[model samples]
Each structure stands twice: as C-alpha cells, then as structure tokens.
Target chain A: MSNTPNRNRQLRSKLGRVRGLGSSHEGVHHWWAQRMSAMALLPLSLWFIFSLISLTGSDYVAFQSWVSEFGNSVFLVLFLVSMFHHAQLGLQVVIEDYVHSELWKMGLLLIVKYGSVLFAASGIFAVLKISLAG
Target chain B: MAEDDRPLSPHLQVYRPQITSVLSITHRATGVFLSLAAVMLTYWLASAAYGPDSFARAQAALESWFGRLILFGFTFSLFFHMCNGIRHLGWDLGWGFDLVKLRMTGVLVIISAFGLTVLSWVMAYSHVGKL
Candidate 1:
C-alpha cells in the first residue's frame, strides 16, 4: 500500500490493464478488512482476556455453563469470525512476501483463505452446539 | 513477474539486527504462527462442545508438556501481537513515526509481551495448575 510507483501503475489500471493488476485489485478491501478486524479485536480481545482470566480455575461444568450463556456464545462467534478473517489476510501477505514461487504462493494463499474459513466455521459451530445443548 | 535481474533492494545481510527490525519481522512470524494455532483453538472448542469425555481428552492433551509448551508460545505470541498491534495503530494514526519513538515502542512491546506471559502463568498457577 505504501509503494507510490505501484499505486501509480495501478492507477493506470482503471483505464484498462496497462501492466498487470488494475486499480480494482488495489487490495484496499483486504487492507480494510484487516484494519477493521484489528479495531474490532481491540475490545473483543480484552473481553476474551478477562473471560479467560475468570475461567482460570474453572472446572468443566463451570466452563460449560459459562460458554452456554447466550451473550458469551454470540461474542465468541464474533471473535472467531473476525479473528479468522484478519488472520487470513495477514497470512496472505506473509505467503506473498516470503514465497517467491508464484505457483506455490498462489496455492498456499488459497489454502490459507479456505482453511481459516473452515476452522472458524468449526469453532463457531462448536460454540453454538455447546450453547444450544446447555 | 519480474524476470530481469535488477540491482534489487538491500537484503538482510546488508544491515545489522536491531530491536526495531527484529520485532517488525517477528510480528509477521507470530501472526502466521497464531493463524496456525487457530486450528488448535478450533479443536479445543469442538472437543468442549462434544461432551465430558471429549473435553477431558482434550484437556489431558493440553495438560501435557508438549501442549503446555505450545500454549506458552501461543500466549507469548498473543501478547506480542497485541502490544505491537497498538504500535501499528499508532502508526496508522500518524503518530510515533520518529526513529527514537519507534525503537522505544519496539522495546516496550517486547517487555510487555514477557510481562504479560509471566503474569498470565503466575495467575494460572495460583488458580489452577492446568496452565
């Protein structure tokens, strides 16, 4: 996002493909999602830290009951979704940075994107299943 | 996409390691690590939702030395990421751009990470030895 030459080059992309990716592919969406998630996590993560602190000595029944609470379940769902979304974006940037092989890079990026979604879904499902049962 | 060999930007070999550089790079590494750790988080949640038996099994695994080590790493990484995340937000808000402030904040993040990790463990140990 900081590359002036890259932005200028991409700015020409709105006119049509001059070199490679267009302005449409400027990656602001990805950046915005990451930023938003970071903002969201600011409070959510604090809540999470306090919740875990409260659960520090809790037993299984305590944890089960705590998680079964409607508010806790809903907050957890939000946390998982935003956390995974932010994580996927971060990993995409990482793979793009270190993995020089274009094919491998693309493969890994796809895996990260899909994998985060799958895992986050599983996490949310777990939260819901427990909350519903209790 | 670049096929031609240009002079290229300076590589890691060109510069001495500093707290700023180290923390900057480790932030990415820890970010990637946390993403992978997210899988384990899912597993734990799934087990918890399953039943007492499954939760017990998961708890046993997490209580193991290997799992504890991993958890420690995860905890440390979380704190580091959190502190550095604040620093990033500062950058986004157009503050702390100066070299001195950057380096100071970098060191503070490192210290905060260790402090948080230690404090967490202490709290856990005082409460439940599970951590």
Candidate 2:
C-alpha cells in the first residue's frame, strides 16, 4: 500500500490519481523472488532434513563424507543461499510493516540484508571446506 | 478516495479468528523464527566443518536439555513453514484459490507439521541405540 502521506496533485495523471493503490514496482520483484526461493526450498529442505536425520546417530566422518559428495555439496550451498535470501526478503517486509520510522526501517533493512548474506556465506564456506578437504 | 477519510479494508480486530487470518499471521511469525534459527543452523554446519573438537561442542550443545528444546522448536517450525510455503507457491501458480481448497490445504499444513514433528522425534529416538 502506498504510505505516501502527501501526493502532488499537479504531477498526477488521470489514471494515476484514480488507481495507484497497490504495491510499488519493486514489491512484485520481491514477491516473485520469495516464491521462487520457496519453491526451490521445498525439495531442498526435505533433502536437508532427511539427510540430517540420516546423520543423527552417525559421527563426524559420516557428516564430512556426506557433504563431501559433489551433488550434496552443491545443493547445500544452493539451499543455504536460497533460504537466507528468502528470509531476508520476508524479514524486510515484516520490518517495513512494523517499523514506521524511516531511519529505523533503513537500519533494520541493512542489518537483515547483510546478516542473511553473512550467514549464507558462512554456511556455504563450511560446506565447501568440508567437501574440499578430501 | 480522500486520504483523511479513505474507505480502507477492515482491520484485523473486525474479523473473527479464522484459519485464513490465523495461518497468514502464523506464516509470518514462523518465517521470523526460522530466520533467527538460521544462525544456529549455521553454527552447526560451521562447527562441523571446523573438525572434531568444534563439532563435539556443537553436538554437545545440540544434545543438551536446553539445546534439544530449541531444536524441537526449530524442527516443528521448519516443517510447518515448509508445508505452508509449498501451499503459498501453489497459490502463486493460481491453484487452490478456491475457499474450500485453501482451507483444506491450510488445515493439511497444520496437521502435517505436527505429524512431522512427532515422526522426526521418533526417528531421532530410534537412533539412541545406534549412537
């Protein structure tokens, strides 16, 4: 919804004045990306959970070798990136909705973006390091 | 519509509690939870990669009473979000837009989340002897 408190009537077109009442253009992209990641995560998350379950009673070597497999390692990175990116997008919206102050909103947005990226990078790095250790 | 007196949609307080509103809000809440849990997930992965000493510490934390409690919460949240997220993706494809189907799938997501939590813990318990 347009939170624009004041609109300049002089610049408003006929259609714009009558019907500009939905997401800003960027929202559609965010929505699309979130759904895209969600779809990807469906299968990836199932695999991750089941794979984790398989490793439950196993040891460090079992964990290492599981991730060391080529396909597993690649998907691990994909799953981490997609999950974090999707999370950042979702949290950004939550922050936007609740935090009305422009300064606080921007600050939270930066933290969510960078923090998710940092976590994703670390997860990916860990996966890669284990897989490559062999 | 005038900004001062715009006919906005009804606020949440106007509606009775229903699956639609409940699930919608729950979806957002679980998303926030999962995002925070990702940090813990990362710790598990990174510690595992760091080798035996680090992973042993990670394992100990995970098996501890407090850690298992957190893990239990995370596990349910993960499956719930996953199931509901798939339902959302279905909506994006223009499926399950009908009221009955939406309600059906929403109920299914909740049911499955519980079913999955029980199943996962059972599976974990079965591994106790194997450990």
Best by lDDT: 2
Query: Which CAPRI level is candidate 2?
Result: medium
What are the per-residue Cα lDDT tens digits for candidate 1 across B1-131? 55535343346667899887788889988988888677887898999998989998988898899988998898888889989999998998999999999999998999999998888777777666555
Candidates' lDDT values, in order? 0.84, 0.85
Residue-wise lDDT of candidate 1 within A1-134, one digit each (tens)?
A: 57466545533544455334446566356767888999998788768766876787566788889999988998899989988998998998878667777799899999998899899999999999988888
As for candidate 2, its clashing pairs are none
| Candidate 1 clashes between residue pairs 3 or more apart in a chain or in different chains | none
| Candidate 2 lDDT by residue in tens digits, B88-127 | 8788789999999999999999999999988988887776
Worst 10 residues of 1 chain A by lDDT: A10-19
- Candidates in order, TM-scores: namely 0.86, 0.84
What lDDT score goes with residue A43 in model 1?
82
Number of clashes found in candidate 1: 0
